[model samples]
Target chain A: AEGEESMAAPADKRPISTIVIIIAMQAEALPLVSKFRLSELPDSVFPKGVPWVRYYGIYKDMNINIIWPGKDTVLGVDSVGTISASLAKGACIGDVFLASDVAFHDRRIPIPVFDLYGVGLRQAFSAPNLSKELNLKVGKLSTGDSLDMCPQDEASLTANDATLKDMEGAAVAYVADLLNVPTIFVKAVTDIVDGEKPTAEEFLQNLAAVTAALDQAVTQVVDFIAGKCLSDL
Target chain B: AEGEESMAAPADKRPISTIVIIIAMQAEALPLVSKFRLSELPDSVFPKGVPWVRYYGIYKDMNINIIWPGKDTVLGVDSVGTISASLAKGACIGDVFLASDVAFHDRRIPIPVFDLYGVGLRQAFSAPNLSKELNLKVGKLSTGDSLDMCPQDEASLTANDATLKDMEGAAVAYVADLLNVPTIFVKAVTDIVDGEKPTAEEFLQNLAAVTAALDQAVTQVVDFIAGKCLSDL
Candidate 1:
């Protein structure tokens, strides 16, 4: 096994050099920034016309940047290209992506997975192989903006056939794919979208707690990436 | 900080001996069981009248058990006491609890936290202190059994004033609190539950994916406990 390990080809070898974490919330980004000791880059540092806030710093010798897509995927598309081009700067070295966001699930459980599609693109990108390493569940994630538009009824879910549904996962996945960033999506569940209750109230009441959980999930991914990169070295 | 670290009382320190994870789905359970290499205990090994199947094994030298509480809080009440007592058998040693399930939020983003109230318990329980270490959000959790019975309009959210809502979190918390066990409730958002789509159809479609996310969150908790315990050693 040691001989086989050493015999592996270098061309087939991809050591993670930089990891770009694209997330949706400032809350989610704050904890990771602090945990990994990330510092916000100057606004002028970002590419011109970039619509979202971008933060950059290093964690354990790996370059890490967190991008906030502000609220939903529609907001993300405006800056996806800018985000992609910026990441392309590190293309000379292998770069991987870990996109984090929230989703609405009908079940009273949160399933984390790489989303499968965005609006225009079919067969969107995902890192299923990596999901296992991170102990995450991989499934088809549906992306849209409004919960009212999201399938809240069993009939809707059956019609959609998407196991995972979110407002932004697919858009991030789609944009990352176009940029050729090997991306893995990390999402934590916050609410059960089964039309049984009013969302505004639930969200307002549980926002702090759910955001906290999302923060934790993001931290785990960051740590996993750090550990994975170090071992690859 | 060095002096503070040194002054930390070793006598008051208790290493985690067992970790109990209560969840609602088989999809969530399968992943954790496999990742941690947990094995099922014989049905007969469980205390008589146990309503749910329990898996017990070791993950990083910690006795980790995964309990399936079926779909909602109503189902959980059946086995919560039994599960609590089982863990109490190892009560002389310190034990920690990680409760994983799904929730509802109004906004698209998923917030992670423990909800506060539910169907039966007038007062609910949650572990907010553990939220930071676990990277989870702590807040009021609302638990109930029927999705239809849940509030489904903006009026409801305004009326409830809760940020997080769920079907089972409070029940589990109430039971854990009653058992006098120190527990941390970890939940991911699944749906907005704010009257978008009818839930029956939606739940059937997205059940698998939501549960998987819950499973991943649970896995993180287990790993956290293991790492925390190992560092203590």
Candidate 2:
């Protein structure tokens, strides 16, 4: 199983000294950025034309990296996966990843997913006790090709017992699979897919309302990162 | 009545040419910040010892300012209001404000509110046709002093036909009331208070999932601002 792969990291490898927070957009990174007062890494530091950009800082004496892939899961498998795999190739056993994003499934319901469900990679690696310790509601998450909050799409996903739907988490997991690292998700419910027909332009309308809550969740995730990975720092 | 106040300003007044995006934390401002690539306003710009801080920039040729009052509506009436009213005293007739935040109302149901509900400000100003054009579900928003997502609290709110609950929107309205400025809420549901004894730590557990949606909603808000206020720009 993928969980065991992380546990069995060879003694000769680096002992996983970093914690990465990957998000789809800058907003998701703000709370952490401000909370840690993170400084933006200069463009000159990265090789030109890289598909992703990151902010680096120290929090609680731990090295924390926050990355935003240029876009969402639309590029997760192809671009994000490749980049993540390369960065994680030499990552140690305790290296942690907390992938965050917005999702839809139930009607006007906000559900937190701690466990990931995908087509393959049943051997997916998850954080040792992040969900259990947080006492959050864990459920199966199905990643789709596009935003799936419409009534018709909701009905289809619900029929299969998939309570959560997203665009990029699975792809991120694919990258984790390639690197044999442990990852967990910290998602917030933005809207319930009732019969309302939402256009791409209207997608983020409710974001302001839910941001206060997202700030709190990200804070918890940071707390968890400090607890589990501070030893490496 | 309030709508008339903002709509009937004298031609010589400041003319309300600015659009302010008010929120509690940096996360809520993420989508808008990145979409506009807003720059932080230095503390020296505002009169010294202000209770809140703001970021300002130009989006689509309109003067856009995003403010975070250090916290939520908990300070809206007292601190946020005094500061906002002072700023709006010279604001123009057509200026717009898009109030954003996470809210909880019914038990386990996240509902969006397009209409502002309070003791009196019934004819309050609204974005010309933004909500109707978008076909969003509009309803009454009841603001309280604390987080109202608790089980017993939710039952009481539903009994009053309150579709949404927030800590800051109504309070922001109080500030708008003082300055006679038009404001609308673009809120998203973050949690359903259905018997889920959510402690302070657990309030934002599901935020990551919903942030993407919130991001989309905020983007739309920015677009609306561009369309409605660009003439002023």
CAPRI-style grade of the A/B interface in model 1: incorrect
RMSD of each: 24.0, 20.3
What fnat does each of the candidate structures reach?
0.06, 0.00
List the candidates' TM-scores in order.
0.37, 0.36
lDDT of 1: 0.45
lDDT of 2 at A89: 21
Tens-place lDDT per residue, model 1, B35-153, is 88888777534433334667888778788888774322222222211111101011111122333332223222222221221112233333333455655544444443234332342
Q: How much is A119 displaced in model 1, in angstroms? A: 5.4
What is the per-residue lDDT of model 2 for residues A1-233, given as tens digits with 9 covering 90 to 100? 12234555452243444667776645566777788777778863443444466788888766777776543222222222111100102222112233332222221212221111113222333543665565444445544333423343345356535544555566566455445455666555554434243422233564544455555666776676564442232
Against the true structure, candidate 1 reaches a TM-score of: 0.37
